[model samples]
Target: MKRIFLIAALICSSIIVLQSCSPKTTSGAPAVKRSGVTGNWVLNNITFDGIPDIAVKSFLGESSYKCFIGSTWSLTNSGNGSYSLPSSATCAAKTQTIFWSVNAADGTFQFKKLYQGDKAKNVTEGYRLMLAAADDVNMTIKSPIEYGNKTAYIIMNFSKAAK
Candidate 1:
């Protein structure tokens, strides 16, 4: 009985590990191409879904969600990028470096902020946002959060910056 229990435990753990390590998207969606995501994008607008705007105090673990408006994000095919925030009364202006990737099948857009001398692989924590849309002209992503014991989303709107 002891040996049988141990084997069962091992099997369960192994399955969990394998699934966690899999390269698939968490939503099990088919891989989407990344061409639309690489370019200069302006965070043109932001909206709250199924929740009041006052419910969200900050975004991307940074300043208030409103501060990100008009921010310019430049993503390259090499997975390197940065977003420059415009000056706001509640948020200071700054440019932050990041390494980002989009899951081919799942539309899971993830990025990790990189500090000086920091390696992307060494950064274990990052932010994940759903890639709602992306193309040569526009892109949209949603940041999901828990609110009132229910799921809420912060919708982000982006437009390609002019050349």
Candidate 2:
């Protein structure tokens, strides 16, 4: 009787352990949905206060615009990524390599300028872009900039790059 009881207890303990160690599953349910920003994208347009920005139009019209080829903005599932500007961009829109993140709670996209090989240095304090909309293939972002005495919305649109 003692031997039988000990064996039964051991088997029960083993079964409990095995069940706890098993991988969890959702029983054929789909995985968590990823954010739409997790891919390479190209700048499509820029608008300032509901009007097309001439500087952006001129920048796109320049011959050096070809240099923007292969330049990409990449976001991650974990809300962090890198943004690389085209090398040949104009002085005012010069190349910038920065780290970016999305704040889902506030619907804001935050950017931090990485400097001197340090990810924590030269951060842009309080500079955040409001995400207007984002689908699998497109995203629109808006930021307020002081234009003269009033604030103007700088809207940027991006299209996802082909795989």
TM-score of each: 0.80, 0.57
lDDT of 1 by residue, 10-67 (tens): 9999999999898963555435577769989999999988889997877887858888
Q: In angstroms, how far off is 6's CA in candidate 1? A: 46
Which predicted model would earn the best TM-score? 1
TM-score of 2: 0.57
| Candidate 2 lDDT by residue in tens digits, 1-163 | 9999999999999999999999975533222223656777877766678333543333232344333444567766654566555555442234454566666656776676555566544554535777777788887777666556767676778899888
Candidate 1 TM-score, true structure as reference: 0.80
**Candidate 1, run of 10 with poorest lDDT:** 24-33
CA error at residue 121 for candidate 1, angstroms: 0.8
The candidate scoring highest on lDDT is: 1
Where does candidate 1 stray beyond 4 Å? 1-31
